[model samples]
Target: MMVPEERRNADAERGEMPVVQGIPIGAPQGGMAMVAFTTLSPEEQVVLNYRLAVMCFAFLDFLTTLLNVLTAVMGTGYYWWELLLLIFLLGPLSGLLGAKHLHQSLTAVYVGFCVLKTIAQIVFAVYFFWLWHILFAFLQIWITKIVFTFCRCLSRIPLERRAQLLDLKEVELRMVYW
Candidate 1:
């Protein structure tokens, strides 16, 4: 077995963070600003993955809202009421607020709103025979799933870890969510 000093030197040469039991104990040598991926706990990994998915969904939601506004302005489709709803309850803003504060209640409210919004979209699709509405409904469902999954995984991580994740400074204390 290699001695501790030799192991440290080898790891340093390889540009790897020093870790113990899969958790990073300190910053990498030479002042590297990246933590090894293996240093994250399983729950953190899940949260990270879900957070990315949620962001993508949020982008899609924004795109759909934009398209609706364009169509309404052009007088091709009367989406005035729908536009009002989207503007009032923009999913991404609520999600970002909840995530930044780590407030489970706000996130839960967001999930509830998403669920209701999805149901309304489905009903509108069926009643109005709008194929595009169906697609948007499906997107909303996916967004809801991603946000719910992220929130569940976030809840599993300790408050201290979550605080560290929000630091956004040093690699050792930062998470990839932002």
Candidate 2:
């Protein structure tokens, strides 16, 4: 009898091949499967990059929100409103819209938000009297830059390799269909 590894290798070699009894490998079935891929097209790579950017934005928003809340509790009160707006409104809203549209526009929105937030942090740091708040603001800005750099690196990866990295089969299917 063939071992499981041997079976998997055979399945992998079958090029646009079928696996299991009913499901064909690389067939796009919509929903989450659409995002699943063992190989990605250029367009899919763009989509993946945008998704990563959105995640980065969310992370930065969360960090800023926490900092703002802590500062407000400690009597600083300088950035509470801005941080609340970003955490409760802007970040979540943009993320929801991005998930709905799954378009490149979301990436642009995320990048714009990051830039704005970074600028806001720097300005707030200069004006704020509380040392802790200023330090947290600076840290948030640095974290945002790191996240942006990481996303840029991800965006630069070759499409074929990204597909392999993401292990996306659905994208391959979409390509076949196209």
Candidate 3:
């Protein structure tokens, strides 16, 4: 077994940072930012993770609303392009507000529910809708399913194997849904 001094030395060698290495920046303004997770308190980390989850929930809602538009056009649901557009804009904005006001765990629950709803709705469309709808739903659900599976796998990882880039709390919060 490793001694306590050895463990502390190893951590110090690894830079003594939080296990979370921070999220990636897809834009060009990034350089070595991957090495940095904000020096925020645990509470701040939770808040940041909650915002990310809330944004994910918002995007899921927008995509679902867009699919509803497709269903309306396909004669399965009511047609309302105006409503879709309104939701496309309002959904994320409202989610942002809600994230700011609601408890993080509550927002996490909403995110989980949205994912389940999206999955169920797509499965329904695949069964009852046209070939094109089936194709669309299948592709969409496949990607979502893969992501869900990945999250579950990530959660199952031994703590030592988890990437320093990952925030375990963030993964744990999202895993509550799966």
Candidate 4:
């Protein structure tokens, strides 16, 4: 039994979701499941790109942690809590909030991530600058730059949104004339 071509095309034109049965999507084409970026609306593309970039940041943090673990195995380095903080804070928050579309909560979490990241960078740089591993110190510098970039992105939300996120109410204005 075959579905008619006209029916399928009409369904697509009417914006109906394709119904699937008995199975789910599997390993993706072109190493990704997503369609071409150009196929997405501009807004959707921006959101997707933002999420992907954050995930990549999280992945890099994990790789850094793995490097540290291996170095520790060789008795040359020890694990650091800062890497865990970076991994947990950078990627997952954006991905989760983006999916939920919780506008108010997003702003608050963004601000919190910014503050914590700033503190982490400050402490890491100040405490580790004198260490012998120049590569590690330089990596911290790069991470600080990355955190600042994220903060800048987060801060670009409208002022009204920030105020709303903070639960600030708008006051009514009244004019009195003599």
Candidate 5:
């Protein structure tokens, strides 16, 4: 029912297509190319989200390490002193490395931290047997489970869905060697 002029005007207002040589560009040269130009891929978003999570975890690790050191310094018992030192050494080290490597590498430092925490929790369960220690053990297990679940879900996402979600575009021009 709408005339060509009206359709062109609507397209211009929406920024859906570029103006080409005074004629409204229909679609990009390729559908995939247009999509790539428009949206961030889902994988990119997931990577970014993972980076943010790592940063948050690193901050928490730093705080926890500091608290542990303070508790140890307060002479809370030799066991507490040793445990706190271990936490101080590993927690901040792994956290800092994970945060620093996030953009450049997909290291398993976070997973390693979780594994170390789990081992520590098991040790606490056997030696301390305190309610707080038990609670912390369970919490670490839960966090590990959740992280694994998220990774699994990300992997299960269909390629097409990922493309649509991520707005991935195919490579266009071939490179020419000089």
Candidate 6:
């Protein structure tokens, strides 16, 4: 669907979602589904972008930890409890909470949890002297920056507008690799 630029702008100003034009969306290679990126205001776009970044990083961390655990089980004969914790904390927990935060309202609890998790990860990384831990700590910090930006953008939006922005059922990725 295509909307004229002038009409889209007018609809946005009137608190209506405008179907964005010219953005192509297709599933990635190997049949991985991609989200459609449209019907969003610029502010919503910014928030969703940050949300997706956090999700991607968290997913990567989960995969890395899972791989580590698998390798340990196959070679070292046992996986550490720490690896389990990382998988649980960074995988489903972070992703679910991130989705909630983005699709709903920004709550203090989620922000606090993110901050505490980041601090703990960094501290543990330093204590353990693990390169991967340190790398993840850096990624956590990057996620924090995105969260901060998301919070700022969300705060500037009025309550009525906020609801509309947060009501998106599926987050649209601005860039889709076909």
lDDT scores in order: 0.65, 0.54, 0.50, 0.44, 0.54, 0.59
In candidate 5, which residue pairs clash? 41-166, 42-166
Model 6 agreement with the true structure over 1-178: per-residue lDDT tens digits: 6556567578887979755542334445665444365455666667656666655654565566577667766776655764564444444355546545553342333455567769978998999989999998997787767666665665666667655555543322334211
Off by over 4 Å in 4: 1-48, 59-111, 131-178
Best by lDDT: 1
Q: Write the per-residue lDDT of candidate 4 for residues 95-167, one digit (tens) a residue.
A: 3453234243443454455455456656766777656444555655564454444444444555454343222
Q: List the residue pairs that clash in candidate 4.
A: none
Please list the residue runs of candidate 2 whose C-alpha ends up more than 4 Å from where it truly belongs after superposition.
1-108, 168-178
Per-residue lDDT tens digits for candidate 5, residues 1-178, read: 9876588678988998675421111244643223223334454455435644655665676688677676776666556436546544554455456444432222345556667778899789779999999998898787665444334444545546544432222222111110
| Candidate 3 lDDT, 36-58, residue by residue in tens | 23344443444444445555655
Off by over 4 Å in 5: 1-43, 76-87, 100-107, 126-131, 145-178
TM-score of each: 0.58, 0.40, 0.32, 0.30, 0.46, 0.46
Worst window of 10 by summed lDDT in candidate 2: 19-28
CA displacement after TM-score superposition, residue 101 of candidate 1 (Å): 4.4
Our model 1 lands, by Cα RMSD against the true structure, at 6.6
Collision count for each candidate, in order:
0, 5, 0, 0, 2, 0
Query: Root-mean-square deviation of each candidate, in angstroms?
Result: 6.6, 9.8, 12.4, 16.9, 11.1, 9.9
Candidate with better TM-score, 1 vs 2: 1
Candidate ranking under TM-score, highest first, comes to: 1, 5, 6, 2, 3, 4
Select the stronger candidate by lDDT from 3 and 4: 3
Candidate of highest TM-score: 1
